[model samples]
Structures are given as structure tokens and as C-alpha cells.
Target chain A: MRNSFLTVVIFAVLVSATYFYLKSPEIVQTKLEVLKENYSKPRDKKPVDHSKFEVLQKQFNSPQEVVKTCMSCHNEVHKELLDSPHFRWQRPVYENGRGVTYLGKANAINNFCIGVQGSEVSCNKCHASFGEEEAMLAIDANAENIDCLVCHDNSATYLKGNNMNGFPDKSVDLAVVAKSVGTPTRDNCGVCHFFGGGGNNVKHGDLEKAQFHTTNEIDVHMADNGGNLICIDCHTTENHNIKGRLFTVESSNTNRVSCTDCHTELPHESTVLNEHTVKVACQTCHIPTYAKVNSVNTNWDWSKAGKLDANGKPFETEDSLGDHVYKSIKGTFEYARNKKPDYIWFNGTAEHYLLGDKISEKETLLVLNKMNGNYNDEFSQIIPVNIHYAKQPFDPGTRMLIQPKLAALAKGEGAYWQDFDWLKAAEKGMEASGLPFSGKVDWFNTVSYWPINHMVSPKENSLQCVDCHNSENSRLAGLNDFYMPARDKYELVDTLGNLMILLTIAGLFAHGSLRYYFAKKQK
Target chain B: MKEVLIYKGYERFWHWTQAVLIIFLAVTGFEVHGGYSFFGYENAVVYHRYAAIGLVVLIFFTAFWHFITGEWKQYKPTPQFVKEQIEYYLLGIFKNAPHPTKKTVLSKLNPLQKLAYFGLMVVIIPLLVITGIIYLFYRMPSATNMNPLNLTNLEPIAILHTIGAYLLVMFVIVHLYLITTGHTILSNLKAMITGYEEIEEDDDHHKKEEKKV
Candidate 1:
């Protein structure tokens, strides 16, 4: 009977194994082949030939002339560009169905340069619309103001002047640039966005010029040897409205671009990992460390600015990473390389303190941009972010952070950079912003958070279980919202469990021995 | 005393293979849990998975062999002499008292041995195998996206698997000590190796019948 049962069981197992071994692979292979076939085909659209456009043949002396020529063919280009936040430098925010305030680089208060109110000339170097006259142009004006070459130019010669009020340098050949205009490449967009906070790899720790051609290990998606995806691939745009946000003031508008738009909510094969996506952002694991190529400015002490050597010449010192740790003109800086991001619960929306907002005097640390979410919020995800700290000027009386006219030093105005005079610079900046400034100027520590959106490591390089589940020195140790298994333990439950296990073993041993002893005594 | 065939060749092969696989699985599994890093995390996980699969295959084969050879009956629990067998190990053996149950080729395991082996095979081993297999393929593509089993966390499964492992470890420790309770220290060990054990000439009927066979 047992032999027959064994034979039947073995036969059943063999049959099932054979079925799966032969059938499952064929099914999976067919599906994989279909997917591969779909992906391998190139995009249907043909590349535009810029050489054929006769309007770009003429020599242009000014950036305005180049814009005028571009508008000749693409007549409605200015209308589209005018509506874009890149051109306007402001986005309208609605509060309770009413337009409250405009937020962007035009009005946003940041730890890095504070505000663009007084530093329009230096800050607007990255502004899309060209010429100083364009800054004053009416919102609905039909004029040659938009700089087409800033994004579309392929000549690589279009260099924007530092103080030229959004105009390119005269040394650039405008005709060559105008003729070579094509689709925006990584280099074109990176020229301004990559070098955001004064210099290359200064502001956002994740973004840098090196991302244009990085190794797969550094960024699996953007790297040339990896996915080789363009910015537009994920940030799919519609009618010139790019689907992304800078680390500026909060806007009422929702972002169209997200990782889930391409990858889906449950991208991971593991069910446990897929579940983590609900409360953990994709970048938290994918981007293990930021600033892979260069060290990022972690802190800036504006109070230490305007320091000079014995010869009266401005001095600068380099950090261990060859980055400027201190410069007499700007401030003392702290740089960090391959930094692990500070994780926080973030929803899509954020709240930012605008310029001239009255802050608490007792509050030493002021948040420039506050992510709107908490542990209880269903929409919140644990996102990795880079926090840039700074000590900047503030009004002692009103306790409001004062934006200093640091850029006005170049124009010989009442700037902090001119004579290291904080009160004069603060007064001028407050006047430009049309806000009342107290005579007494003080410094306050502030933090500005920039969400890490780049430098994605390969899947294999992602953090393991114990990375966050450890009791000590864990990345998620600071996060007390959720109970992590290995990292958290209930004292009573642990003690009881240990006691039970100990008692069970002891009881079993004692029972066996005592029964034997009694039986031996009776014998 | 006379030599009699006890463990068969296939039985011995199954025993040794299962022993080695279990030990390998335990070492690698514990390392993967961050207990201690020997082969590093990645390598430990890989080896643990392989050993688990190997054990699963061995289990099926051994189960089939045991049923086919009519050796499954050896592990059938008999209440008779169970107390005596327990007393022999705990106190009787120490006092030089005689064993209550005699060892035979057909019924080699004592009543206490039957109970322990039954618990291990029916409860603990199955628990370990089921949980281990679940963990191994939990990340497989087919198991993901609309997870039917709702295996959203590894914590619960991991805890269960660890408990099963501890039980098996305890069983192994007791088993190692029990082998020393034979007539001679090396007697049981020699029986498992050479497939023969010495038994007292109790029945003349079996002695003449064995020689004739």
C-alpha cells in the first residue's frame, strides 16, 4: 500500500514539474519578445533640419535682433513663451478661489541669495526672455523679447552675460547661433538650471553638469551607458509648460511629471518593496547618495563675507574636496560630497515663507520652504532631500528676514558686498522689495530644502534591510513615525516571549528527568 | 552479540544529505539575517536559497523512498514502553538499567524517538520548508502586483522561519547526545555508517530464519 502511494506521489510531482518546465518558459518568452519588439522600434518623427530656414541666414548684432528673426517664422512663439513661468519669472497662486500672490524667483525667499528683488540683474541672467527692456514689457505685449537661442541654440556659443540684463555676450556669433537652433539638448537646459545657485554644482546636490555624460553606477536613468533618457522623456511637457518645479516659493499648480508617470506605483517585483512605494518615494532608495561628481555647498555663512587679507585683496580658501570653502566676496561655505539625504514625509504640495513675512525672534532656525505632510497624512511619502543651511540678515524689530542687496556691489550701490555694511544693504533691499525694514539688522539661521531628483544609483546598489532596520546608526533612525521591526521592540512583549521559551525548555527537561527518577525509585 | 542490517544504503544517503543541507541553510540563512557576515550578504542569500531548494528536493525523494521501502512504519508512535524509553535516557541508562524496548530491523526507532521524529517531520520541518519557499520566491515577478497572498511584509514570515530554525537546531543537539546512549559510545555511530548493529541473541527463531534467508 505504501509503495503504491509513493509511486503515485512521485508520478504526480514529475507530471507537474514537466508541465511547468516546458509550458511556463514558452509563455514568458513570448511576452518578453513582444515587449522587446515594441521597445526596439525608433520614434516616428523625423529630425528638423535647421539649415533650411532662410530667416537665420542674416547676421544679428543683438539678442533682440535674433529674437525678431525667430519670431518672423515662428510668430506665436512669444505668446507661448510669455505665458511660461520661465519667461514671466512668476507663477500666480490662488488661495480659496482667489488669486493671492505671485510666486517664483521674482518673489521667493531662499537661503541662497535670499530674494531676486534687488539682485534682478545678477539673478535674471538665467531668465528665458532677453534684454532689460523685456523685463518692463507688458504681459500681453507682442514684441521680440523672448530669447529663442537660450534653449534651442546648438552652436554652443550663446553665452549670457553675468550683468548684461538677460542678453548674451557680444562676443558670441548671433547668426551662427540663430542658424544652429534646434531642439534643446542637455547642455542647453543645464547651462542655467545645472549652475543655479551662483556656480556649477552649488545649489542642488543631485544635479550637476557631469550628469550629461555620467556612468551607469552614478545615475541609472540619465547616464549615457544606462537608460540615456532626456529631461523631456520623464518631464513630458504640453504647450511650452514644462512639467517640473524649481526649489522656489510654493505654487498652487500641481506638477504633471512624476516617477510613477513612467514606472507605475508598483514598479518593484517584490511585493514588500512594492508596498513601500505607498509611503516611500522612489528616490529614497534609488538615489542612495547625491553629489556624485562634485561636492555641494551644504552651508553658507553670509556673516563671514567681505573678509580681506593684509594686502587688502579678497581671499578665498579651498576645502578638502577642492571646492571654495570661503571667499571674501560671498561668505564662508561648507561642502559635502556623496551626501546621504535627510528623509522627510512630503506630499506634492509645500508651504514657503514669502519675503517680509514676520518670523519669531525666539526661533533660531527658520524654514524657507516647508514640505506639507506628516506621518498621519495618507498622501505623504518619505522623500530624500538636501537641506542647504545659511545665516542671513534679518530685521531685529519686526523679526523678519531681510534680503540684502549683495549684487549691487558691482554697481557701487549700498550693497553688503561694497563695504560689508549690513544695515545699508538691508535698507536698500527692503526699499526695492517695498517692505519696511528695521534699523537694527541681525542674523538668523535658516534652512532651505531641495528635493533630490537626480544621481539615481543602480537597483543593485540600493540600501539593504539592515540599513534602516538597525537599532543604532540607521538612516531612518530619526524617523519615529512608523514602527520598523528590527529597530523597534516592545519591552514587555520581548521579556514575556523570552521567559516563555526558557520555561518551555526547562519544563521539558525537568519533567523527563523527574519521571525517570520516580520510575527508578519504584523499580 | 551479532551484527544485523539496520539502515539501508538509500536511507543513509538521505540522512547525510539532509543533515549537510540543513546546516548549510542555517548558517547562510542566519548570515542573511545580519546575525554575522561570513560570505557577505549577497552571497549568503544566494547560498541559502540554493540550499533551501536542495533540501526541498531531498525531502520529496526521502519521503518517497521511506514509503516505498516500508520504512515509514518505523516512526509510528507506540505508547507502550514510551515512558520506559524516556526513563532509560533520563535516569535508567545512568543507573545501568536494561532498555525496555529492543531494537529490530523492522522497528528500529524507540517510542520516544518516534514521537520526536514525528514532530520534526510533521510540524517543524514543514513549517521551515513552507516559510523558506515563500521567502525565496516572494520577490518573483509572478508573485508581485495584486499579491493574492498579501505578503506585504517580510517581518512576520522571517520571524516564523527563525523560530522553525531554532527548533531544528534544538532537535539536532538532542539527537547528537542521544547517539552516545548506545551499548558502546561508538556503537550507534558505527551502525549508521556500516548499516549494521549488534543485538543480543534473544530469539532462536529469528537467528535460524535470518541464516536461511
Candidate 2:
């Protein structure tokens, strides 16, 4: 009887085991299907709008020589702007802007020139107008100053009647004008500053690197809607005005203006930094303004080349050996003869050009030698620079300096240009400085040394939240989010996860209870 | 009259070892599933995994012991009264009914006990083991040809592992409650603890025959 009972129990167990094994797959499948179905339901979410600036298609020309006119009354402000890059145009010089000169005027225009003629209407918008064009008069009527209040009014909007040039009128409300332009935007600075252009155009710097702003698009200082680095983001009109460098000269007059005045603390907080008081000064590390030319400041000294003065005397500058493209010493030159013995130079900005190309050592030295070592590494050096030339097809009157060989001319020893490969030299330099050299070339040459500015470089560009709090500041940073509102929605994976866990727990409990009852009854 | 050695020392050893391991696995496993932390979640997980691995290894040894000793015959179930055992569990369990099958030294567990124990060993344990392994090494993939460890989310695997945990919890609850239903309210419990049980002999003739032997 005991043996038979054992036999019966073993037989029943085998059958039950087989049945459970077969049923498990179906149970697991059903549970998984239910979870998958539940997960498909949509959750409310939105994508993030990260762009801060908008591109305005309209262009406007001012009727009066407003900048010049204002300059007569405000000499200090006039000098500051004149020294700044805004007044200069890197385009070719024109006679009457109509190809009219004493030599029967063929349009082989000069690439660099000083300010525009007073009588021309095309030049008036960006230039100073003398008087009414219909009745040309005194030069005083055309001002040399840039009035801060005109385009900077925050409370105004461009009315149809006020904007005759079909240029978008920068009319703001008087209330906003009473206050400050809502912290600055990329557009506020981009109105005059630009990067990358056609042949003979000046590419001021490399703004196309991904590490800097994650894109190739040039970011005007005021463009960040979320309130990125503005003009005052780093350079303060107060502390920066009285500060050491000209770029950071903070005058009591512009006291409240520092890039830090509005941007405040550093946008990037270090994981190590615990205290706020120990924060660094903006220009303490950023030192000088960026430029493409190896000249004293952004102002190129054309007088260096010997030119016949009005009295027709040979006037040679300290550095110039009378080797340049321009015939007159006072006029700007497109190319310069190499003065250094150990290096080679290339005037290939016109020929093989991309914003960021690697310069070959053999090819570069060959070009440097041809220019007699007077090679400006800012332009001729092996590093890549996307040149943004005069694009409007019209001259803005001021000479825009473009130097290509300044980076390689440092240390004044061992002909560093020849001894070192331009690529290695730059890479090492950037690595040591902890600066990115993807395609951004914004180093300025003052006297013999090149100083890098953090303000102009994308390193200084911000990713701040408050960069676009006020509408007047970030024209696009705020607008882009609205244009494409970001929705942070929950994904289907989460729903499925919840369902699987719930059903699995419930089913297991029920099955176990049933098993317990069966086991208990046989006891 | 009948003298049969139903279980040897090693046989009882393996049975009790397996039972302890299962119980430990269930308790710690639930704790790891964020169910009221006892010994903390991290400690509970460590204990659960250790017990599970021990249990799996014990199963191999137990299966070998069973085969060598022919103890696998104990789980053999008969169809006669199989339906009655099922009905007893389904309906009569609540009515305080008498048990349909009896336990002898040579033939210990009834048809229902055989069936439940067999399902657990063959199906549930293996399922738990597979799901547990997937959970532990879900982060580390050894595929040489695949893209460098692209797994960013762990929620799905976590859910599956948690399901296995819940199953173990249910089994433990029912198993614990069933121990109280034996004769004298503790006979089976005493038998497992001491390896001896007092069997009820209802036939006086059979008793006289056993005494004469």
C-alpha cells in the first residue's frame, strides 16, 4: 500500500510539473502584452527651446551723420567707438561709389579704405551726412558721434512712418529708454560686428567651433533669449572702464557698464568652487581684445610704409621698408613684404581658404620667405580663419585691417615660425592655456605681442538663465522657446514598467495562495 | 509489521537544507524589493543573492542524492483520490474536513504534496534563477560585436526582477501558513524538526499483527 501510494504521488507530481511548465510561457506572455499596451499611452511633455536670438531681415540707413555729429559734442565717446571695430569696413574703396576716378575708373577697387565721402547717400546711413543732400553745406551738420539713446530705447517700437529706409525701425518705448536696454543681446552687438565673409571680406574670428557654442552659427552678444553673455556680460562700463586695458577701460562716465555688470557671476560654476566671494575678475584672465592683424591694436598703421606726403617727402614708419601693395603710405595695403629672415609666408587668404584649415609647415615657410618675413601670422600663418570681407558691395569708409601671421611671430627668438610647425605650435598653445582652438581665431596683436581676450572668444559666450529675462535684451533667446515651446513629456517606457510590476505581484500572490490551500488539504 | 527506512540522514539533511535556503531567499528577497527593510535593503540583497546561489547548488546535490538513494519515488503520485485532494483544497479546506490521504513511513507525502513540491522544484525555482541572473549582470554585457555598452535605462529589467521577488514572497506566506494544518496542529512541524512522527493507527487487528511480528 505504501509503495502504491508513493507511485501515485510521483505520477501526480510529474503531471503537475509538466502542466505548470507549459502554462508559464503563456502567463508571462500575457503579462508582458498587458504592460506593453499600457505603456503606449502618451504623456504630456514639451521640448526645450534653446535658441536665444532672431535674425532680422531688415536693414536701415540713418539720414544724418548722427555718429559723427554726436562725436563733435562727445569727444570721449567718439574716440572710443573710432578705436572700436564698428567704424571700420573691410571692403574695397570706391569713388562716388560709382566707379568714378581720374584714371577713367575701372572697378579694380582698393580692398581697404578710410571713411566714406560726405556727399554720398549710400554712405550716409552708416556714415555722417554733412547737410541736406539736395543742398550740401557745412561738415559740422554731419556728426561724428554715436548717440546711445537713439537705437537703445527699450520702451519703443519701430513705427511704419519713422522707418523710411525700409530698415526695421529700432524704435523702443520711452519708458524702456528711461531704463537700460534690457541687459544686452547678441543683436545689440551684432548690429556692426560680424564673422565669416566672401573673398576680400574679413572673417573677424572663428565662432564655428562646436565646443564653444555647439554650432557654426555666429552668436551676436545680445542674441541669447535665456540671457547669455552680453556686451556687458564681461566688460563692465564701471570697473572695466577704469580697468587696465583699453577694451576694459571703465570710466566713471560709463561706470555702471561691465559685461559682469549684468552677467554678474561666472555662468560656469566649477565643481570645486564653494564660496561666491572668491570669484574671479572677468578681464583678470581675458587681458586683450582679439584681432586678425599683427598691428598696434585693431588700428592698422598704414604710415609704416614710406609714402609721399602732401609736400612729397618720403615718410617711412619705424617697421616699414617700403614693401606693400598701396602706392601711398597713408593708404591701407592688401599685402606686405615679409621682413623676417627665418620664416616663410603665404598670401593664400584669397586662394585655398576655409575658416579652420591646418597650415602645412613646408608650404607656410615657403610663403613666409617670399614675404621677406614681414609675414603677418594673423593672416599668413598656417592656422585657419574664415575671412568675412566687405559684403554689402559698398564701402563703409573706414579701413578694416586683416593680418594673418601674428600667432607665429611671438618670442622674437630662433625664428619660432620656422623652428615650430604652425599646427603643433597652436595646438600646444591652446592646450596649455586650456582654450579651445576648433576654428575660433580671435587673438589681437598689439605692438609685437599677441594678447587673447576672453570677451571676444566663445569661451566667454554664456549659457546663463537670466540672459533673456527682459524682452529688450534677448531678441531671440526668449523668442525661440516661444516659437518652439519645449515639452518635457513622460515616455512610454515608464508606464510599461509600472504595469509589469503591478500585475506580476498580484498574480504571484494569487497563485501562491492557491498552492498553499492544496498543500494544506493533504496534511 | 512493516519496517521501511523512508529517509536516511543525508536525505533529511538535503530536504531541511533546501527548505531553510528557500525561506531565507524569500525573506531577504522581499526586503530587497523595498518591502519594509529588515537588515536594510543593501544587506538584504546580499543575503538574498547568497541564499539563492546556495539553494541552486543544493538542488544539484539533492537531485544526485535522490537518484542514488531512489528517494525520487517519494514524489510519485496516484490518480486515485487525486480529484478528491483537489476538491478538498478548493472547497473542503474551509469546512475542517478530514484529510483524504494518509502518510506512512515508506510513503510520506500525499498526491497534493507531491504535485506542489514537484512544480516548485521544476518550474518556479528555475524561473527565479534565470530572472535573478539577468538582474544581477544586466549592466555588464560580454558581447564583443555589439556597440559599446549602450544600455542607458535599467527600468524594464528592474521590473522583471521585482516580479520574481513578489512570487517568492507569495510562496513563503502560503508555505508558512500551511505548516499549522497538521495533526495535533504541529505533527508535520515536529516531524521535520526531529525526523520522527507519531502515526495514528486506527485498526486494532493491524496493531496486533504488527505486535506479533
Candidate 3:
């Protein structure tokens, strides 16, 4: 009796402990209220009204004069800004064969825009520098001309000039923008990042113009009424060097931010869900579909770029959803919104397709990048990606991608936009980039991967087990290297398991029937 | 009816409790293996883990009781009546012939029962419990990155556990059917429940009574 009572006591204690274990991850409403009260919204704690300062009150006649006045007071900050990848347009990388090479926005080849090697004047609009027009390979840029107000401006009216060496626009009041300088806002970062590839939601499917005043359905963190978190909340910057990087321009995994910086590695209420975090990233489930607002550029076929209207002038057409379906100067395009992302195995490292890298002849579909991990790699996890396909020009003889001059440096200087001639544009573009372009130009299909890391959904909208654990239409159906329950079946296990149980049932039925026959005969 | 003490109070308590717990475990365990869903996936996983821990504790107390009272000797197989027990189960039960061996307090199990129970305690139970523990804690991060030994790759361990679970299901079915082979249809179950059975006045008990007198 004593032992039975003790057993019941122990059983109750174990059960109660397990109940609490399942309940412990939930936060009470009152505790969340306290957390919200204590949580510091994105703002500079030290308030300094710059309008009252004596230096800022002076008339800033020109863009260079505005920089000259700001340098007089907050000096030596330009040194940190000069060394950043934002200003230099490249990061110092140690390649496998070549010792150390600078490869990034300037020299790296992407499917969109090709590169910035010979087209620095137009591309330098987002380069975070001023008056460094032809910085294709220039490293020792003048720190005296760094544009400080582009990020520090609180004035919302500042705008960079269109194709004028990244100066403040002709309409911008330089004096007003200089006096309103405080810290970077969502608008300051979104002016370039949100509109990366010429328009909204073009480069990254997760980022777009709607993220400035976003809703919870688009992003849980940056939503205007939700977490209201700015980019730097989880991005945690040290000095002028920001704490994140995108694989499109970067080749290494050293300086990047992750969800684990703010959330724990195992943040789920259930232990089963936490175990999946080891082999799967947080974004793979949280961000089920990207580009929730506007349609992102999915395909670009540059082979149809030379088409003209009846009047011999360039024309453009839009799809039913207002996406630019065809453009005379650029090419044909296909866009999609609320799209499910493709998956890849990544461990933060990337192998970018540099300018001089040779393209393989056997591979019909050339991937610009995205070969950083394998299934056997210990540091790898399945991450979601948005693959943008493009039909771009390539050389048949040398097997290298052709960098055709798309925009004109001088009028009719072999620019494809000016003359609409492929041969001459290839010649001038290769000459400017220091490569020998073959006379023959051919078009080939190319694919590139952009990892989607934003637009987190709410907790209730996360994927269930049936999403990836089912036999059909599994989200992870592409990854077949490992055995997953409900998806993978081994022949030996199925056969042995079935035989063992079926034999037990057959034995019972035969024995029971024979015994009944014998007993009835005896009676 | 001559009612004899065929089971002790503690033995009845543990046997019925173990049967209920094992059936509950199999129901939840198979669901987690993607067989079918009685409970939802999340609930199945949670309850399966809890029941596995409960069975481990139950086995601890059972082994302690068996060792303290020296009742574990009942399950030590002897090859003397092995063939006779097999033959009786195969053919003699249908013809209403006599049993191959007699049951007593000290020797509760026959030759076939001894072998099955011995393997159950020594092999299958331990296999399921150990594999279950590794399955529960697989890929769980520790101070040294993972577990103490840092064992990964859950495929092999899960397969082994799954095989053991199937074998246990087979054992439960066969064991349930054999309970009807006693003197009456439900005599064995009644003996376990009430700690008494209408045993025959056989020579084994007569000899013990003679020695006591």
C-alpha cells in the first residue's frame, strides 16, 4: 500500500512537471505589456537639435560647401566611412588561387545590370560617396568628399542627383538638409536598398518600397503597428561598419547578421520544433512567401532588347498588374508576387561569379553564384532563396559573359542604349573593362540566387508538419539526401515490420478456430 | 472451487499497470512514426516522450522488486520441458490434453514463458528505452555543441527503435491471446486481478503440504 501510494505521487509529479514544460514557453499578456513598455523604439537617445548650432545656420550654397561645414565640427568620422564596403564598392576577399582580391559591386557580375566596372557614373548614385565618379577600381577615394547627410539626415527631403556623380539633386535645399541631420531612418536606408534594381522589389523579393510603412502581414518586425523595429535593431552596427551583408556582392560569411542574434537558437515552445532548427534556418519557415505587396522581377530576357516601335523610337508595355512586361532599352520581363521561395543549402559562405571567371561549356544553365554548401557539410542548413532567371549575352569563342555598354558615356559611343548595336557595344565595354571581347555575340540562359531573409509571418501562420512531412507537395521535396519520416520509406523496414505483426495475427486466428472446433466436437 | 494464492498483491499491482502503460505508449509511439494519427503530431510527440520516461521508471521499480524477492529466478529458462511445452501449445491444447508443466509460486512460468519473458526483460525493453532516449535528445545542443558524446544522424537510431516497437506490438498480441489458454477462458486475467486462482490439487502442492505437515 505504501509503495503504490508513493508510485502515484511520483507519477503525478512527473506529469505536472511535463505540463509546465509545455506551458513555460508562453508569455503572459501582462508580461508582454511590460516588455513593450521597456522596449526602446529606434531613436537616438542623446537629443541634439542641430538647428540651434552656429555652423549649420550658415548658408550652404553648394553640395561641396555643405560637406566642408559638417567636417569642421564632427571631424575624423569620414575615415571610418571611407573604409566601409558602402564607399569602396568592394570588400577585400582572399580567393582560393589568387591571394587577396577586392570583389564586390564594382567587379562582381550579376544577371541584372551586368556590372559597374565601366558604368560608375550612373551606378555611383548609391555608392555612399560624392565626386568619386570613375571608381571602378579606385580604392584611395578622397575622404574629404564623403556625403555624411545621406544617412544622418533627419530631414526627409534630401535626394541624390540623377546620374551626376552622386551629388544632392538640383531641387534639394542643401542648407535645410544639413541642419536636419541626426541619424538614419527607414527612409534613408530604403531610398537605395528598397529600390535596388531600378524599381521597387526588383533585386530582393523580400525587400520593397512597401517596407517603409509596412503592415504585419508583410513583416512582423518592421511593421508600422507591430514590432516597429528598424533595420539596425537586429543589424547591430559597430562604428561605421554595418553588421550585415548580402551574398550578391559579398563572397565570405564573416560579417553577417542572423536571427539568432535577437532570438535564441531554440525559440519554439515544443522540443520537437527546436530540434529542427539545427538543420533548418528560421527564415525557411517564418518567411513562407516573399514579395507580399508588389510583383518582383522574376525573369529578364535581354535577347529582345533591340525591338522598336513604328516611329523607330523605344517603347514600353505593362502587364495587367502594372509590372513592366517589356521595355525597348532593357528587355522583356516577367514578375510575380506572394511567391513560394526555392530552397538551397547555405552556410553563410558564397562563391560570386567575378568579372574574369570563365563560364563552363558543358553547363547550359550558368548560375552566377550559390554553391556554398553540400548535404554532408556540418555547418550547412536549408535556406529559402528567390532565383531570378535571365537570358543574357555571352561570347561563343572565349566562353565569357559579354559586358555590353548599356548606357552611353558619350553620345553614340557604342552604347547599346544609344546605337542599339551589339557588336560595337561589346567592343567598347570589353575595352573599358580590360578584356578582349570576341567579335561574335551569342545569348545564353543564366540563373542567380538571392537568399530571402525578411518578411517574417506571425507565429500562427508558420508551417505545420504536414507541409514538409507529407509524401506529396512537400516544401523540402528538392532535398532528398536524408531520410525524413512520412516522406522517405526504406524497403527493409516496411517488409520486416509488416511480417512481424501479420504473423502474430495469423497465429491467433488459426489457433482460436481450431480450439473451438475441438471443443464443439467433444461436447 | 479451491482458490489458491497464484499472484501476490504487489505482482498484481505492477502487472496491470505495466499492461496499460505499454498499450498507451504503442498508440502514441506509432503516431510519431507516421503510421496514423490518433493524437495530433505535436501531442503525439510530447505524450510519447512522457510515456517512455514513465516506462523507464516503472522498469526500474520492477527490476528492484524482482531482485529483492528473488522472483527473477522464475524466468530463468530450463531446457528440460521446452519441447513438451511447445508440443502442448501446438497440438495438445486443441485435443484437451494435460499441460506439460505445473505452476507454483516459486516457478510461475513454464519453459516457453520463461524464454519469452527473459528476452522481453533482457533485450527488447532495454533496446526500446535506450534508443528512445537517444532519439529524444538527438541534435539537442549542449555546452559542447550537442550531447555529451555528440551523436548525430537519427536515421539508424530511429529505424532500430521502430523495429523494436514492432516486435513489442507482436509480443503484446501473442501474449494477450495466450492468456485464454489457462484452465478457463479468463482464469489468467482473473488471477492477475484478484491475486487468487482456482488451482487444481496437484502433486506439486501435495508434496509441499506433506513437507510442511
TM-score order of candidates, top first: 3, 1, 2
Q: In candidate 2 chain B, where is summed lDDT lowest over 10 consecutive residues?
A: B138-147
What tens-digit string does per-residue lDDT give for candidate 1 at A124-145? 6888866554553447744677
Q: Give the per-residue lDDT of model 3 (tens digit) for A1-523.
A: 6876776677568767866775475433233344355555546675788888888887777776887787888677767777777777787886545557887776777888787655556677776777645254244566656778788778899888877667778888888898888768788888889888778998898988899998888898889877787777777777878888788777676778888765666566566777688778899999989989998888999898989999888899998899999998789999999999988888777776777678887879988875587555667788999999999888887788888877755667788877788898788778878988879899989889999998999877777776777666889899887667666656698688889789879979999999999999999
DockQ of 1: 0.07
Question: What are the models' TM-scores?
Answer: 0.74, 0.30, 0.91
Model 3 chain B: weakest 10-residue lDDT segment is B140-149
Q: Score the docking of each candidate (DockQ).
A: 0.07, 0.03, 0.42
lDDT on C-alpha atoms for all candidate structures: 0.74, 0.36, 0.79
Task: For model 3 chain A, give the 10-residue run with minimal summed lDDT.
Answer: A26-35
Off by over 4 Å in 3: A7-35, A38-46, A95-99, A131-134, A137-139, A409-411, B140-144, B204-213
TM-score: which candidate is best? 3
Local accuracy of candidate 1 as per-residue lDDT tens digits, B1-213: 789988876676667778888888878876665445677665676567666776777788879788987888888776777787877776777566777666778667877999999999999999999988777655311222433454445556767776787678668766776686677767998998888899776587655533432
RMSD of each: 7.2, 25.4, 3.5
Instruction: Give the backbone clash total of model 2.
Output: 111
In model 3, the Cα lDDT at residue A279 comes to 75
lDDT ranking, high to low? 3, 1, 2
lDDT of 1 at A320: 68
